[model samples]
Target: MSPEAGTGSPIGGTLPRPRSPATRDLGMRASLLFPDREVAERYYLPLIYTACRTCYSELEPQEIFDRATSGRVTTDKQQDLIRRVIESGHGSTIEHIVFTFAISGVTRTLSHQLVRHRAGVAFDQQSQRYLDYKRPSYMVPGTIADAPVEVRERYLAEMDESLAFYGEMLEAGIPGEDARFVMPNATRTNLIMTANLRSLIHMSGLRLCTMAQWEIRRLFQLIRHEIFTVSPFLGSFLAPKCVPLGYCDEDRNRDEHCPIRPHKDNVLAAWAEKRAAAKAKGREVPTL
Candidate 1:
Protein backbone atom coordinates (compact mmCIF):
# COMPACT_ATOMS: atom_id res chain seq x y z
CA MET A 1 0.00 0.00 0.00
CA SER A 2 1.14 3.53 -0.75
CA PRO A 3 2.12 5.45 2.39
CA GLU A 4 -0.04 8.38 1.32
CA ALA A 5 -3.18 6.48 0.26
CA GLY A 6 -5.64 7.81 2.86
CA THR A 7 -6.72 11.33 3.72
CA GLY A 8 -5.14 13.19 6.63
CA SER A 9 -6.98 12.57 9.88
CA PRO A 10 -8.27 15.08 12.40
CA ILE A 11 -8.66 12.23 14.89
CA GLY A 12 -5.58 11.20 16.90
CA GLY A 13 -4.47 7.75 15.69
CA THR A 14 -2.50 5.97 12.97
CA LEU A 15 -3.68 2.85 11.14
CA PRO A 16 -2.84 0.90 8.01
CA ARG A 17 -3.91 2.51 4.74
CA PRO A 18 -4.80 0.56 1.62
CA ARG A 19 -3.48 1.44 -1.82
CA SER A 20 -6.42 3.16 -3.50
CA PRO A 21 -6.48 2.71 -7.25
CA ALA A 22 -6.54 5.68 -9.60
CA THR A 23 -9.76 5.94 -11.61
CA ARG A 24 -8.09 7.66 -14.59
CA ASP A 25 -10.15 7.46 -17.83
CA LEU A 26 -11.07 3.75 -17.29
CA GLY A 27 -13.98 4.14 -19.75
CA MET A 28 -16.32 5.46 -17.06
CA ARG A 29 -17.71 8.86 -16.06
CA ALA A 30 -20.10 10.43 -13.56
CA SER A 31 -21.23 14.01 -14.10
CA LEU A 32 -23.57 16.08 -11.96
CA LEU A 33 -26.58 16.70 -14.22
CA PHE A 34 -28.53 19.07 -12.00
CA PRO A 35 -27.93 22.10 -9.77
CA ASP A 36 -25.12 23.81 -11.61
CA ARG A 37 -22.90 26.06 -9.50
CA GLU A 38 -25.33 28.96 -9.72
CA VAL A 39 -28.29 26.84 -8.66
CA ALA A 40 -26.34 24.98 -6.00
CA GLU A 41 -24.84 28.14 -4.60
CA ARG A 42 -28.09 30.12 -4.71
CA TYR A 43 -30.72 27.55 -3.81
CA TYR A 44 -29.51 24.17 -2.55
CA LEU A 45 -28.39 25.39 0.85
CA PRO A 46 -31.40 27.62 1.33
CA LEU A 47 -33.69 24.74 0.37
CA ILE A 48 -32.08 22.49 2.96
CA TYR A 49 -31.99 25.24 5.56
CA THR A 50 -35.67 25.79 5.06
CA ALA A 51 -36.29 22.14 5.70
CA CYS A 52 -34.29 22.24 8.89
CA ARG A 53 -35.72 25.52 10.14
CA THR A 54 -39.27 24.43 9.44
CA CYS A 55 -39.11 21.84 12.19
CA TYR A 56 -38.60 24.49 14.89
CA SER A 57 -39.85 27.75 13.37
CA GLU A 58 -43.48 28.72 13.65
CA LEU A 59 -43.30 30.55 10.31
CA GLU A 60 -44.64 29.00 7.07
CA PRO A 61 -42.09 27.05 5.01
CA GLN A 62 -42.34 29.54 2.12
CA GLU A 63 -41.61 32.40 4.50
CA ILE A 64 -38.64 30.50 5.91
CA PHE A 65 -37.42 29.71 2.38
CA ASP A 66 -37.83 33.34 1.31
CA ARG A 67 -35.90 34.50 4.36
CA ALA A 68 -33.19 31.96 3.64
CA THR A 69 -32.85 32.49 -0.11
CA SER A 70 -33.29 36.27 0.00
CA GLY A 71 -30.40 36.60 2.48
CA ARG A 72 -32.43 37.74 5.44
CA VAL A 73 -31.02 34.62 7.02
CA THR A 74 -27.28 34.96 6.47
CA THR A 75 -25.72 32.03 4.67
CA ASP A 76 -23.27 31.49 7.51
CA LYS A 77 -26.08 31.24 10.06
CA GLN A 78 -28.10 29.01 7.77
CA GLN A 79 -25.09 26.78 7.22
CA ASP A 80 -24.37 26.62 10.95
CA LEU A 81 -27.93 25.55 11.69
CA ILE A 82 -27.98 23.09 8.79
CA ARG A 83 -24.66 21.58 9.79
CA ARG A 84 -25.75 21.14 13.37
CA VAL A 85 -29.03 19.56 12.31
CA ILE A 86 -27.28 17.12 9.98
CA GLU A 87 -24.68 16.13 12.58
CA SER A 88 -27.51 15.53 14.99
CA GLY A 89 -28.82 12.87 12.57
CA HIS A 90 -31.86 14.81 11.42
CA GLY A 91 -31.80 12.97 8.10
CA SER A 92 -35.27 13.94 6.90
CA THR A 93 -34.25 17.60 6.81
CA ILE A 94 -31.62 16.97 4.17
CA GLU A 95 -33.85 14.73 2.08
CA HIS A 96 -35.76 17.79 0.85
CA ILE A 97 -33.03 18.42 -1.76
CA VAL A 98 -31.60 16.07 -4.37
CA PHE A 99 -28.76 15.60 -6.84
CA THR A 100 -28.96 14.06 -10.29
CA PHE A 101 -26.02 12.54 -12.15
CA ALA A 102 -25.29 11.47 -15.71
CA ILE A 103 -23.40 8.20 -15.31
CA SER A 104 -21.92 6.37 -18.28
CA GLY A 105 -19.61 3.49 -19.26
CA VAL A 106 -19.66 1.84 -15.80
CA THR A 107 -19.75 -1.95 -15.64
CA ARG A 108 -22.85 -4.03 -14.99
CA THR A 109 -20.96 -5.16 -11.89
CA LEU A 110 -21.01 -1.61 -10.53
CA SER A 111 -24.54 -0.85 -11.66
CA HIS A 112 -25.79 -3.86 -9.73
CA GLN A 113 -24.27 -2.61 -6.49
CA LEU A 114 -25.33 1.01 -7.06
CA VAL A 115 -28.99 0.38 -7.73
CA ARG A 116 -29.16 -1.49 -4.44
CA HIS A 117 -29.56 1.87 -2.68
CA ARG A 118 -33.34 1.95 -2.98
CA ALA A 119 -34.66 4.55 -0.58
CA GLY A 120 -34.44 8.25 -1.51
CA VAL A 121 -32.71 7.38 -4.81
CA ALA A 122 -33.91 6.49 -8.27
CA PHE A 123 -31.96 4.87 -11.13
CA ASP A 124 -32.68 4.43 -14.82
CA GLN A 125 -30.18 2.16 -16.52
CA GLN A 126 -29.63 1.39 -20.19
CA SER A 127 -31.82 -1.62 -21.01
CA GLN A 128 -30.20 -4.54 -22.80
CA ARG A 129 -33.72 -5.62 -23.73
CA TYR A 130 -34.37 -2.37 -25.61
CA LEU A 131 -30.99 -1.18 -26.89
CA ASP A 132 -29.12 -3.63 -29.11
CA TYR A 133 -25.44 -3.30 -28.38
CA LYS A 134 -23.30 -3.16 -31.52
CA ARG A 135 -19.81 -3.05 -30.15
CA PRO A 136 -19.99 -3.77 -26.45
CA SER A 137 -17.26 -2.44 -24.21
CA TYR A 138 -16.03 -4.06 -20.98
CA MET A 139 -13.79 -3.39 -17.99
CA VAL A 140 -10.55 -5.16 -17.14
CA PRO A 141 -9.63 -5.10 -13.49
CA GLY A 142 -6.11 -3.95 -12.65
CA THR A 143 -5.26 -7.51 -11.62
CA ILE A 144 -6.16 -8.77 -15.08
CA ALA A 145 -4.63 -5.75 -16.81
CA ASP A 146 -1.32 -6.29 -15.05
CA ALA A 147 -1.34 -10.07 -15.30
CA PRO A 148 1.37 -11.96 -17.21
CA VAL A 149 1.05 -11.81 -21.01
CA GLU A 150 -0.54 -15.22 -21.40
CA VAL A 151 -3.00 -14.67 -18.53
CA ARG A 152 -4.06 -11.21 -19.69
CA GLU A 153 -4.40 -12.42 -23.29
CA ARG A 154 -6.60 -15.32 -22.18
CA TYR A 155 -8.85 -12.98 -20.19
CA LEU A 156 -9.25 -10.63 -23.16
CA ALA A 157 -9.86 -13.51 -25.54
CA GLU A 158 -12.59 -14.97 -23.37
CA MET A 159 -14.35 -11.58 -23.07
CA ASP A 160 -14.11 -11.03 -26.81
CA GLU A 161 -15.48 -14.50 -27.53
CA SER A 162 -18.43 -14.02 -25.16
CA LEU A 163 -19.38 -10.71 -26.76
CA ALA A 164 -18.91 -12.10 -30.29
CA PHE A 165 -21.12 -15.09 -29.53
CA TYR A 166 -23.82 -12.75 -28.20
CA GLY A 167 -23.70 -10.87 -31.51
CA GLU A 168 -24.05 -14.13 -33.40
CA MET A 169 -27.09 -15.06 -31.31
CA LEU A 170 -28.65 -11.70 -32.20
CA GLU A 171 -28.07 -12.39 -35.90
CA ALA A 172 -29.71 -15.77 -35.47
CA GLY A 173 -32.93 -14.05 -34.25
CA ILE A 174 -32.45 -14.51 -30.51
CA PRO A 175 -34.05 -11.69 -28.50
CA GLY A 176 -31.64 -9.05 -27.22
CA GLU A 177 -32.78 -9.80 -23.67
CA ASP A 178 -32.01 -13.49 -24.10
CA ALA A 179 -28.73 -12.76 -25.89
CA ARG A 180 -27.80 -10.37 -23.06
CA PHE A 181 -27.56 -13.44 -20.80
CA VAL A 182 -24.21 -14.04 -22.45
CA MET A 183 -22.94 -10.60 -21.40
CA PRO A 184 -20.47 -10.70 -18.56
CA ASN A 185 -20.70 -8.60 -15.41
CA ALA A 186 -17.76 -6.60 -16.80
CA THR A 187 -19.82 -5.40 -19.76
CA ARG A 188 -20.16 -1.62 -19.59
CA THR A 189 -23.53 0.02 -18.96
CA ASN A 190 -24.93 3.49 -18.38
CA LEU A 191 -27.37 4.97 -15.88
CA ILE A 192 -29.14 8.12 -14.73
CA MET A 193 -29.28 8.28 -10.93
CA THR A 194 -31.07 10.87 -8.80
CA ALA A 195 -30.64 10.73 -5.06
CA ASN A 196 -31.82 12.89 -2.22
CA LEU A 197 -29.07 14.50 -0.17
CA ARG A 198 -29.67 12.16 2.78
CA SER A 199 -29.49 9.09 0.57
CA LEU A 200 -26.44 10.45 -1.23
CA ILE A 201 -24.71 10.91 2.12
CA HIS A 202 -25.69 7.40 3.20
CA MET A 203 -24.55 5.90 -0.11
CA SER A 204 -21.30 7.86 -0.06
CA GLY A 205 -20.69 6.70 3.50
CA LEU A 206 -20.64 3.09 2.31
CA ARG A 207 -19.18 3.44 -1.19
CA LEU A 208 -16.36 5.80 -0.12
CA CYS A 209 -15.13 3.34 2.51
CA THR A 210 -11.94 1.42 1.75
CA MET A 211 -13.87 -1.81 2.29
CA ALA A 212 -16.09 -0.96 -0.69
CA GLN A 213 -15.41 -2.50 -4.10
CA TRP A 214 -12.80 -0.41 -5.93
CA GLU A 215 -14.92 0.57 -8.93
CA ILE A 216 -17.81 1.81 -6.78
CA ARG A 217 -15.38 3.66 -4.52
CA ARG A 218 -13.90 5.35 -7.58
CA LEU A 219 -17.38 6.20 -8.85
CA PHE A 220 -18.23 7.94 -5.55
CA GLN A 221 -14.94 9.80 -5.69
CA LEU A 222 -15.93 11.17 -9.08
CA ILE A 223 -19.38 11.97 -7.74
CA ARG A 224 -17.81 13.77 -4.76
CA HIS A 225 -15.59 15.81 -7.09
CA GLU A 226 -18.60 16.81 -9.15
CA ILE A 227 -20.43 17.90 -5.98
CA PHE A 228 -17.37 19.80 -4.79
CA THR A 229 -17.31 21.81 -8.00
CA VAL A 230 -20.77 23.11 -7.18
CA SER A 231 -20.88 23.03 -3.36
CA PRO A 232 -17.90 22.01 -1.30
CA PHE A 233 -19.84 22.39 1.94
CA LEU A 234 -22.30 19.71 0.86
CA GLY A 235 -19.53 17.71 -0.80
CA SER A 236 -17.75 17.40 2.55
CA PHE A 237 -20.50 15.13 3.81
CA LEU A 238 -19.92 12.56 1.06
CA ALA A 239 -17.24 10.51 2.81
CA PRO A 240 -16.52 7.12 4.33
CA LYS A 241 -19.00 6.00 6.98
CA CYS A 242 -16.13 6.01 9.46
CA VAL A 243 -15.64 9.73 8.82
CA PRO A 244 -19.10 10.56 10.13
CA LEU A 245 -19.18 7.82 12.76
CA GLY A 246 -15.75 8.81 14.18
CA TYR A 247 -14.64 5.14 14.03
CA CYS A 248 -14.53 2.32 11.51
CA ASP A 249 -17.39 -0.18 11.96
CA GLU A 250 -16.63 -2.83 9.35
CA ASP A 251 -15.79 -6.18 11.00
CA ARG A 252 -13.07 -6.62 8.33
CA ASN A 253 -11.26 -3.58 9.72
CA ARG A 254 -10.44 -5.46 12.94
CA ASP A 255 -7.11 -6.40 11.37
CA GLU A 256 -6.68 -2.70 10.47
CA HIS A 257 -5.85 -3.41 6.80
CA CYS A 258 -7.57 -0.23 5.55
CA PRO A 259 -6.67 2.22 8.27
CA ILE A 260 -8.85 5.18 7.45
CA ARG A 261 -10.14 5.21 11.04
CA PRO A 262 -9.64 3.29 14.26
CA HIS A 263 -11.93 0.27 14.29
CA LYS A 264 -15.05 0.56 16.48
CA ASP A 265 -13.98 -2.36 18.64
CA ASN A 266 -10.70 -0.65 19.51
CA VAL A 267 -12.46 2.64 20.20
CA LEU A 268 -14.92 0.93 22.55
CA ALA A 269 -12.16 -0.92 24.36
CA ALA A 270 -10.33 2.34 24.98
CA TRP A 271 -13.54 3.92 26.19
CA ALA A 272 -14.07 1.06 28.61
CA GLU A 273 -10.55 1.52 29.96
CA LYS A 274 -11.25 5.21 30.53
CA ARG A 275 -14.50 4.38 32.26
CA ALA A 276 -12.74 1.92 34.52
CA ALA A 277 -10.11 4.50 35.49
CA ALA A 278 -12.85 7.02 36.20
CA LYS A 279 -14.63 4.47 38.43
CA ALA A 280 -11.36 3.82 40.30
CA LYS A 281 -11.33 7.55 41.12
CA GLY A 282 -14.89 7.22 42.59
CA ARG A 283 -16.37 9.16 39.63
CA GLU A 284 -19.13 8.31 37.19
CA VAL A 285 -18.38 8.08 33.48
CA PRO A 286 -21.01 8.63 30.84
CA THR A 287 -21.97 5.63 28.72
CA LEU A 288 -21.77 5.68 24.92
Candidate 2:
Protein backbone atom coordinates (compact mmCIF):
# COMPACT_ATOMS: atom_id res chain seq x y z
CA MET A 1 0.00 0.00 0.00
CA SER A 2 1.17 3.55 -0.71
CA PRO A 3 2.08 5.44 2.47
CA GLU A 4 0.66 8.68 1.11
CA ALA A 5 -2.74 7.51 -0.19
CA GLY A 6 -5.51 9.34 1.72
CA THR A 7 -5.84 13.07 2.41
CA GLY A 8 -4.04 14.40 5.50
CA SER A 9 -5.45 15.31 8.91
CA PRO A 10 -6.65 18.81 9.74
CA ILE A 11 -6.39 20.78 13.05
CA GLY A 12 -9.41 19.12 14.63
CA GLY A 13 -10.30 15.54 13.58
CA THR A 14 -13.95 16.09 14.58
CA LEU A 15 -14.83 17.39 11.13
CA PRO A 16 -16.58 14.74 9.07
CA ARG A 17 -14.58 13.24 6.24
CA PRO A 18 -17.45 10.80 6.01
CA ARG A 19 -18.49 9.25 2.71
CA SER A 20 -21.78 10.51 1.29
CA PRO A 21 -24.87 9.48 3.22
CA ALA A 22 -26.70 9.16 -0.10
CA THR A 23 -24.42 6.35 -1.28
CA ARG A 24 -24.85 2.61 -0.61
CA ASP A 25 -22.88 -0.53 -1.46
CA LEU A 26 -24.40 -2.69 -4.20
CA GLY A 27 -21.08 -4.63 -4.32
CA MET A 28 -18.37 -5.07 -7.04
CA ARG A 29 -20.82 -7.01 -9.20
CA ALA A 30 -21.52 -3.57 -10.62
CA SER A 31 -17.88 -2.52 -11.01
CA LEU A 32 -15.55 -5.44 -11.84
CA LEU A 33 -16.88 -6.32 -15.28
CA PHE A 34 -13.73 -5.93 -17.35
CA PRO A 35 -10.99 -7.88 -15.51
CA ASP A 36 -11.65 -10.12 -12.54
CA ARG A 37 -9.43 -9.97 -9.44
CA GLU A 38 -7.23 -12.92 -10.42
CA VAL A 39 -6.96 -11.66 -14.02
CA ALA A 40 -6.02 -8.18 -12.81
CA GLU A 41 -3.32 -9.52 -10.50
CA ARG A 42 -2.01 -11.90 -13.17
CA TYR A 43 -2.28 -9.73 -16.31
CA TYR A 44 -3.46 -6.10 -15.84
CA LEU A 45 -0.86 -5.07 -13.26
CA PRO A 46 1.81 -6.94 -15.17
CA LEU A 47 0.74 -5.18 -18.38
CA ILE A 48 1.35 -1.86 -16.63
CA TYR A 49 4.26 -3.55 -14.93
CA THR A 50 5.70 -4.17 -18.40
CA ALA A 51 4.87 -0.67 -19.69
CA CYS A 52 6.81 0.91 -16.87
CA ARG A 53 9.65 -1.60 -17.14
CA THR A 54 10.13 -1.10 -20.90
CA CYS A 55 11.15 2.52 -20.22
CA TYR A 56 14.25 1.35 -18.29
CA SER A 57 14.79 -2.28 -19.35
CA GLU A 58 16.65 -3.39 -22.50
CA LEU A 59 13.71 -5.77 -23.20
CA GLU A 60 10.43 -4.83 -24.98
CA PRO A 61 7.12 -4.24 -23.11
CA GLN A 62 5.58 -7.39 -24.63
CA GLU A 63 8.53 -9.35 -23.32
CA ILE A 64 8.34 -7.71 -19.89
CA PHE A 65 4.60 -8.40 -19.43
CA ASP A 66 5.09 -11.97 -20.58
CA ARG A 67 7.82 -12.51 -17.99
CA ALA A 68 6.08 -10.55 -15.21
CA THR A 69 2.68 -12.24 -15.66
CA SER A 70 4.31 -15.62 -16.09
CA GLY A 71 6.13 -15.22 -12.72
CA ARG A 72 9.61 -14.95 -14.21
CA VAL A 73 9.86 -11.34 -12.91
CA THR A 74 9.50 -10.70 -9.18
CA THR A 75 6.35 -8.83 -7.90
CA ASP A 76 8.58 -6.35 -6.03
CA LYS A 77 10.40 -5.33 -9.22
CA GLN A 78 7.11 -4.94 -11.13
CA GLN A 79 5.60 -2.82 -8.30
CA ASP A 80 8.76 -0.69 -8.00
CA LEU A 81 8.62 0.12 -11.71
CA ILE A 82 4.88 0.91 -11.47
CA ARG A 83 5.47 3.17 -8.43
CA ARG A 84 8.17 5.26 -10.11
CA VAL A 85 6.21 5.60 -13.38
CA ILE A 86 3.06 6.70 -11.51
CA GLU A 87 4.90 9.18 -9.24
CA SER A 88 6.65 10.69 -12.26
CA GLY A 89 3.22 11.20 -13.91
CA HIS A 90 3.99 8.96 -16.90
CA GLY A 91 0.20 8.36 -17.21
CA SER A 92 0.32 6.35 -20.47
CA THR A 93 1.80 3.35 -18.66
CA ILE A 94 -1.03 3.28 -16.09
CA GLU A 95 -3.60 3.68 -18.89
CA HIS A 96 -2.90 0.10 -19.97
CA ILE A 97 -4.91 -1.19 -16.99
CA VAL A 98 -8.63 -0.62 -17.47
CA PHE A 99 -11.75 -1.26 -15.39
CA THR A 100 -15.21 -2.18 -16.63
CA PHE A 101 -18.26 -1.42 -14.47
CA ALA A 102 -21.88 -2.51 -14.62
CA ILE A 103 -23.27 0.62 -13.01
CA SER A 104 -26.82 0.17 -11.81
CA GLY A 105 -29.39 2.01 -9.61
CA VAL A 106 -28.01 5.48 -10.27
CA THR A 107 -30.02 8.48 -11.43
CA ARG A 108 -30.14 9.79 -15.03
CA THR A 109 -28.79 13.08 -13.67
CA LEU A 110 -25.67 11.23 -12.50
CA SER A 111 -25.26 9.37 -15.82
CA HIS A 112 -25.28 12.68 -17.77
CA GLN A 113 -22.21 14.00 -15.94
CA LEU A 114 -20.46 10.56 -16.09
CA VAL A 115 -20.73 10.26 -19.90
CA ARG A 116 -19.21 13.75 -20.38
CA HIS A 117 -15.71 12.30 -19.94
CA ARG A 118 -14.49 12.10 -23.57
CA ALA A 119 -11.06 10.52 -23.06
CA GLY A 120 -9.93 6.93 -22.52
CA VAL A 121 -13.41 5.69 -21.64
CA ALA A 122 -16.50 4.11 -23.22
CA PHE A 123 -20.08 3.93 -21.97
CA ASP A 124 -23.26 2.24 -23.15
CA GLN A 125 -26.23 3.40 -21.07
CA GLN A 126 -29.45 1.43 -20.77
CA SER A 127 -31.85 2.93 -23.31
CA GLN A 128 -35.00 4.25 -21.66
CA ARG A 129 -36.85 3.87 -24.96
CA TYR A 130 -35.97 0.22 -25.51
CA LEU A 131 -35.97 -1.00 -21.90
CA ASP A 132 -39.38 -0.06 -20.56
CA TYR A 133 -38.70 -0.51 -16.83
CA LYS A 134 -41.25 -2.81 -15.29
CA ARG A 135 -40.15 -1.71 -11.82
CA PRO A 136 -38.57 1.70 -11.78
CA SER A 137 -36.69 2.97 -8.73
CA TYR A 138 -35.13 6.29 -7.65
CA MET A 139 -32.59 7.52 -5.14
CA VAL A 140 -33.63 10.30 -2.77
CA PRO A 141 -30.84 12.68 -1.83
CA GLY A 142 -29.76 12.63 1.84
CA THR A 143 -31.01 16.17 2.35
CA ILE A 144 -34.44 15.15 1.10
CA ALA A 145 -34.36 11.80 2.88
CA ASP A 146 -33.77 13.50 6.21
CA ALA A 147 -36.50 16.06 5.69
CA PRO A 148 -39.77 16.06 7.65
CA VAL A 149 -42.32 13.37 6.82
CA GLU A 150 -44.62 15.87 5.07
CA VAL A 151 -41.80 17.15 2.84
CA ARG A 152 -40.44 13.66 2.10
CA GLU A 153 -43.95 12.38 1.27
CA ARG A 154 -44.47 15.28 -1.13
CA TYR A 155 -41.13 14.67 -2.86
CA LEU A 156 -41.80 10.97 -3.33
CA ALA A 157 -45.34 11.76 -4.58
CA GLU A 158 -44.04 14.10 -7.28
CA MET A 159 -41.52 11.42 -8.42
CA ASP A 160 -44.28 8.79 -8.45
CA GLU A 161 -46.52 11.13 -10.46
CA SER A 162 -43.80 11.62 -13.08
CA LEU A 163 -43.23 7.86 -13.52
CA ALA A 164 -47.01 7.26 -13.55
CA PHE A 165 -47.41 9.76 -16.36
CA TYR A 166 -44.75 7.96 -18.42
CA GLY A 167 -46.54 4.62 -17.95
CA GLU A 168 -49.85 6.24 -18.82
CA MET A 169 -48.41 7.73 -21.99
CA LEU A 170 -47.03 4.34 -23.00
CA GLU A 171 -50.41 2.69 -22.30
CA ALA A 172 -52.17 5.36 -24.37
CA GLY A 173 -50.32 4.19 -27.54
CA ILE A 174 -47.50 6.73 -27.36
CA PRO A 175 -44.22 5.23 -28.56
CA GLY A 176 -41.65 4.34 -25.89
CA GLU A 177 -39.25 6.89 -27.40
CA ASP A 178 -41.82 9.68 -26.93
CA ALA A 179 -43.03 8.37 -23.58
CA ARG A 180 -39.52 8.46 -22.14
CA PHE A 181 -39.54 12.25 -22.51
CA VAL A 182 -41.80 12.39 -19.44
CA MET A 183 -39.29 10.48 -17.30
CA PRO A 184 -37.76 12.64 -14.60
CA ASN A 185 -34.07 13.08 -13.72
CA ALA A 186 -34.88 11.17 -10.53
CA THR A 187 -35.37 7.95 -12.52
CA ARG A 188 -32.75 5.23 -11.95
CA THR A 189 -30.47 4.09 -14.79
CA ASN A 190 -27.91 1.40 -15.59
CA LEU A 191 -24.72 1.56 -17.69
CA ILE A 192 -21.48 -0.14 -18.65
CA MET A 193 -18.45 2.18 -18.33
CA THR A 194 -14.98 0.95 -19.26
CA ALA A 195 -12.18 3.37 -18.39
CA ASN A 196 -8.43 3.16 -18.36
CA LEU A 197 -6.54 3.68 -15.07
CA ARG A 198 -5.67 7.30 -15.86
CA SER A 199 -9.23 8.13 -16.90
CA LEU A 200 -10.60 6.48 -13.76
CA ILE A 201 -8.33 8.65 -11.62
CA HIS A 202 -9.30 11.77 -13.59
CA MET A 203 -13.02 11.03 -13.39
CA SER A 204 -12.76 10.22 -9.68
CA GLY A 205 -10.98 13.55 -9.10
CA LEU A 206 -13.82 15.46 -10.75
CA ARG A 207 -16.85 13.51 -9.54
CA LEU A 208 -15.55 13.25 -5.96
CA CYS A 209 -15.19 17.03 -5.72
CA THR A 210 -17.43 18.92 -3.31
CA MET A 211 -18.57 21.13 -6.20
CA ALA A 212 -19.90 18.12 -8.16
CA GLN A 213 -23.62 17.26 -8.04
CA TRP A 214 -24.50 15.09 -5.02
CA GLU A 215 -25.93 12.18 -7.03
CA ILE A 216 -22.84 11.72 -9.22
CA ARG A 217 -20.52 12.08 -6.23
CA ARG A 218 -22.47 9.29 -4.52
CA LEU A 219 -22.06 7.03 -7.56
CA PHE A 220 -18.29 7.48 -7.44
CA GLN A 221 -18.34 6.58 -3.75
CA LEU A 222 -20.04 3.31 -4.63
CA ILE A 223 -17.59 2.64 -7.46
CA ARG A 224 -14.61 3.23 -5.17
CA HIS A 225 -15.99 0.73 -2.67
CA GLU A 226 -16.21 -1.90 -5.40
CA ILE A 227 -12.58 -1.39 -6.43
CA PHE A 228 -11.47 -1.61 -2.81
CA THR A 229 -12.98 -5.07 -2.50
CA VAL A 230 -10.65 -6.52 -5.15
CA SER A 231 -7.50 -4.46 -4.79
CA PRO A 232 -6.91 -1.87 -2.07
CA PHE A 233 -3.69 -0.67 -3.68
CA LEU A 234 -5.29 0.23 -7.02
CA GLY A 235 -8.53 1.41 -5.36
CA SER A 236 -6.63 3.87 -3.16
CA PHE A 237 -6.21 6.16 -6.18
CA LEU A 238 -9.96 6.78 -6.39
CA ALA A 239 -10.19 9.65 -3.93
CA PRO A 240 -11.43 13.26 -3.95
CA LYS A 241 -9.62 15.89 -6.10
CA CYS A 242 -8.41 17.72 -3.00
CA VAL A 243 -6.97 14.49 -1.60
CA PRO A 244 -4.63 14.04 -4.58
CA LEU A 245 -4.01 17.78 -5.22
CA GLY A 246 -3.20 18.46 -1.50
CA TYR A 247 -5.67 21.37 -1.45
CA CYS A 248 -9.20 22.12 -2.58
CA ASP A 249 -9.65 24.24 -5.78
CA GLU A 250 -13.44 24.34 -6.08
CA ASP A 251 -14.84 27.89 -6.09
CA ARG A 252 -17.37 26.99 -3.42
CA ASN A 253 -14.60 25.65 -1.11
CA ARG A 254 -13.49 29.23 -0.40
CA ASP A 255 -15.87 29.27 2.56
CA GLU A 256 -14.17 26.00 3.74
CA HIS A 257 -17.32 24.27 4.98
CA CYS A 258 -16.39 20.85 3.54
CA PRO A 259 -13.14 20.73 5.58
CA ILE A 260 -11.71 17.58 3.96
CA ARG A 261 -8.53 19.55 3.23
CA PRO A 262 -7.26 23.11 3.30
CA HIS A 263 -8.49 25.22 0.37
CA LYS A 264 -5.97 26.40 -2.25
CA ASP A 265 -6.60 29.95 -1.01
CA ASN A 266 -5.37 28.90 2.45
CA VAL A 267 -2.18 27.43 0.99
CA LEU A 268 -1.51 30.63 -0.97
CA ALA A 269 -2.23 32.72 2.12
CA ALA A 270 0.32 30.73 4.15
CA TRP A 271 2.91 31.13 1.39
CA ALA A 272 2.30 34.87 1.25
CA GLU A 273 2.58 35.13 5.03
CA LYS A 274 5.93 33.33 5.03
CA ARG A 275 7.16 35.57 2.20
CA ALA A 276 6.19 38.73 4.11
CA ALA A 277 8.00 37.45 7.23
CA ALA A 278 11.06 36.73 5.12
CA LYS A 279 10.91 40.22 3.56
CA ALA A 280 10.72 41.79 7.06
CA LYS A 281 13.96 39.92 7.86
CA GLY A 282 15.58 41.52 4.74
CA ARG A 283 15.41 38.22 2.80
CA GLU A 284 13.73 37.70 -0.55
CA VAL A 285 11.55 34.68 -1.38
CA PRO A 286 12.34 33.27 -4.81
CA THR A 287 9.67 33.73 -7.49
CA LEU A 288 8.91 31.20 -10.19
The estimated TM-scores of all candidates read 0.91, 0.84
How many clashing residue pairs, candidate 1? Answer: 0
Per model, state how many residue pairs clash: 0, 0
Scored against the true structure, residue 180 in model 2 reaches a CA lDDT of 84
Please estimate how well model 2 matches the true structure, expressed as its whole-model Cα lDDT: 0.75
* lDDT per residue as tens, model 1, 1-288: 011112222322333233564533466789999989999999999999998988898999999999998999998999899999999999998988889999988889999999999999999999999988888878876655555667656877888899999999999999999999989898888999999999999999999998899889989999999999999999999999999899999988898877889999999899888889989999977755
lDDT of 2 at 199: 92
RMSD of each: 7.0, 7.9
Off by over 4 Å in 2: 1-19, 22-29, 279-284
Poorest 10 consecutive residues by lDDT, candidate 1: 1-10
lDDT of 1 at 106: 86
Name the weakest run of 10 consecutive residues (lDDT summed) in model 2. Answer: 1-10
